[model samples]
Target: MRFRRLRAIALKELLQIWRDPRSLMIALLMPFTQMFLLGYGVTLDLKHIPVCTFDREASQNSQSLLKHFEASSYFAIARNVRTYPELISAIDRSDCKIAIVVPPDFSERLNDTGTSSVQAILDATDDNTANIAYGYAVAIVSGYSNDVALDALGRQGGELQQIQPVAVQSRVWFNEDLDSRNFIIPGLVAVIMALVGAQLTSLTISREWERGTMELLVSTPVTPSEVMVGKLAPYLALGWIDASFCLIIATLWFGVPFRGTLFTLFATTTLFLTVVLGIGYLLSVLIRSQIGASQVALLLTMLPTTLLSGYVFPIDQMPTIIQDITYLVYSRYYVTIIKAIFLKGAGIAALAVPILFLLVYAAAVMTLAARAFRKRLD
Candidate 1:
């Protein structure tokens, strides 16, 4: 609590961080590395899907149908085959994700019977990709079908009449372009902060034990509160630096829209960083070995934050039991809060619930970390 003692402890910790090459690399370079890697490397939007074409009739109608797939941005015609075995070979060689096949009677059926089916062969290895490809293919075919019907009507009788009982209009809010980066980058803030903060603070007291400086630390007149706060102060500043770096990269470099105010972003980041630092410090106090403390901190912070915080996967899609367990993961609240702030531009009033949970979590972990450390060598 005394400023002089606290300042001395903080200065010592900062000096240690400055002198250690590993700590400097982690604090200075790791944020940029992780942000670029996770931001650009991860995405959900699939485009330029490889497709193979097999036209049995080789008619103008079949050529026209193939043209539709070729024109679509989602489908790229990678191979054209005449025989079924060749089509199968192309698929087996992974030349394509979807195969477009026009039946021999496709044109005849459409001309005479006013109906024809185009077969879509999918590689179901990646079911999600396959499903999306199938949806795209269906949409293209539906549009083509409408075009064909209109042409036939115009030739047979007159102009086609358009009538609709209901028209559905959709307005996309927040992520207008449906860019995954907007949401993913915000969650990355939580992940990166948790990882960097915990990894750094977890080494502080444990480094003292490893270097035989515990006696010096114990003999100091500073209380446990002063030592803990002093040790965490430097890391808290590093955490802020990393957070600001991530926000800048997310908004400027990656073009992820940051709709939230600066105050909301930094305020929540501080609370989240406190929880991360406390967890690391608690582990460092409990486990005296530096390597052991660092590993334990990774296990406690990184894994849970990535897996349980809805970073890449949707929580509702998870098993009911797993979804329930996510409530205990503090990063989940921070992730949700940051995403809301970034995407929805949510204010403090709208974010009260998650912020309250995060505040309680920060207070609880700091309490445990403070109590876990003692002045004696037991």
Candidate 2:
């Protein structure tokens, strides 16, 4: 009897899900599109800066300094301006993001004294671009000075003065290359999983109630627990497909590293999906209409997972109270797990805490949902 009821409920849920083309497209295509768009768009790697130079002196030293900028890949001398007005106009018109002004005494000052300074005006409107430009300017000037010092030492044939020197070492733990794709792809998995799990499961269960088929099912020997499990089985399969698609595109198309065991990734994802589906089922029980259930599911899943999940933003940077609240959000732990697994090559031991927290969340939420659903039926 239980087996028959389970089969009937699972078939009904699958049919309803297949009937909706809009929801299906959202589940399948949105993840791939979002990952690719954000991966390419929001990258921090800087390249190809347009700059204008106003050289008043036009001396050998000034020309040599300009040559330094040309040699570096970061800057391309887009325009040569006669006066400060031209440079300012170019910058304001978005023709140049940085401008270098070489004063009239540039060569004289450098020849008379070992130290000389030039004005480097960077457009600070775009913070990331400005920071990259500043670094590029410092690097070019430092390289020029080092070469000059080396040449001067060779001419005099004297001991070189050794200034303060310290070695700085840096190691990027998860992503050594700091590739943005690796970070964004894994985070997309979390968001997509949450969206699909919540929306599909809620709509599936609620539609039956709205159409009065739930009353028919309840009149049979089937218990609410059996009906709930049956409704979830097919959606669980669909969730797995969503997860598999994300993993394939992230690894094959995007060239993201899959450092951890596939088994570990899939197992954790199964647990995560189960929790989301259970929550959706619980929402279906609370709301009487299909529209109300769908709205609640979308709102509850999208905002919390995207904002509080620590996927795009760092949870540590959030206020202390919000950080404490993150304990209840399964995505927060799952994001850490995915990033660690894909980028850091973390093993089960490293992911134990997150796994444990997910298990607790799944169990607690499912139990509550089952109770809530049972009460609604009675």
Choose the strongest candidate by lDDT. 1
Q: Please give each candidate's TM-score.
A: 0.96, 0.87
**TM-score, prediction 1:** 0.96
The C-alpha local distance difference test score for the whole of candidate 2 amounts to 0.82
In model 1, the clashing pairs are none
**True-vs-predicted CA distance for residue 268, candidate 2, Å:** 1.4
Worst 10 residues of 2 by lDDT: 369-378
Q: How many residue-pair clashes does candidate 1 contain?
A: 0
Clashes of each: 0, 0
